[model samples]
Target: MKEIDFSKLIVTLVQPLVQEPSAITVTERDTERYREYVLDVAATDVGRVIGRQGHVASALRTVVEGARNKHINAKKIRLVINDHRH
Candidate 1:
């Protein structure tokens, strides 16, 4: 298991799908049960990241979770997408 930069990974995966690349932001919050990654994108790009029927978002979460599971860590990881009108 190696140190994984989940925030950077998310940003890299999402940057191309957004119109305002500079507005993309990823933040982390730690809880007793899990670590949460909050992804904020320009309001207009939200749909792009989410994709139709939320398939893209689901896929993104899958990738992130898969990586986390590969490492031997007790804490779980969560991905949250938020839209902002920056």
Candidate 2:
């Protein structure tokens, strides 16, 4: 899978866990230097995606990083969980 696939994966993973699956948004940013991914969850369901003790978020980062390594495009990638649950 490619970068966009990761975004889709986030949606797929979080959709069933939340009441409003449509509220999930995965935003990607690319620059000459690096690519950044931000997972945005609904204010009401942030806890679901994050899980307990940040384990879910860490797992997400690990998966994306592993995928990037396999693709080996020589790019720096950052996966971020931007909690907009305020």
Candidate 3:
């Protein structure tokens, strides 16, 4: 199986929804049971990314989860979104 560039995928998905594309950041972390992707967006753009009632976030997770299932055979994957605070 090919290695998935989850960080880049996440950035690509999130960039269009934010006011400052350059401020978006995606970090990956490995745990015992799951690989986590932490997506941090600008504080002002947090709501836009999250969407009303979390619909946008849910869709993002669904897509990433699908990619993991299709392209990788390893631990479960997680997507976490946060606001980058300065």
Which candidate gets the maximum lDDT versus the true structure?
Answer: 1
**Per-residue lDDT for 1-86 in model 3, tens only?**
67778899999999989899998888889999889999988899999998999999999999988888544547877999985563
Which lDDT value does model 1 have at 2? 75
Model 1: per-residue lDDT, tens digit, 14-63?
A: 98898999999999999998889999988889999999999999999999
Tens-digit lDDT track of model 2 for 1-86: 44446677667777887888877888989878777878787787888778899898778777777767546556776777778744
Q: Could you tell me which 10 consecutive residues in candidate 2 have the lowest summed lDDT?
A: 1-10
Query: Quick one: how many clashes does candidate 2 have?
Result: 0
TM-score, candidate 1, is 0.88
In candidate 2, which residue ranges exceed 4 Å CA deviation?
A: 1-4, 31-33, 69-72
Better candidate number, 1 or 3, judged by TM-score: 3
lDDT (CA) per prediction: 0.88, 0.76, 0.87
Segments in model 1 whose C-alpha atoms lie over 4 Å from true places: 69-71, 84-86
TM-score for each model: 0.88, 0.75, 0.89
What are the RMSDs of all candidates, in order?
Answer: 2.2, 2.6, 2.2
Candidate that would win on TM-score: 3
Error of 1 at 48 (Å): 0.5
Once superposed on the true structure, which residue ranges of model 3 sit more than 4 Å away at CA? 84-86
- Residue 16's lDDT in candidate 2: 84
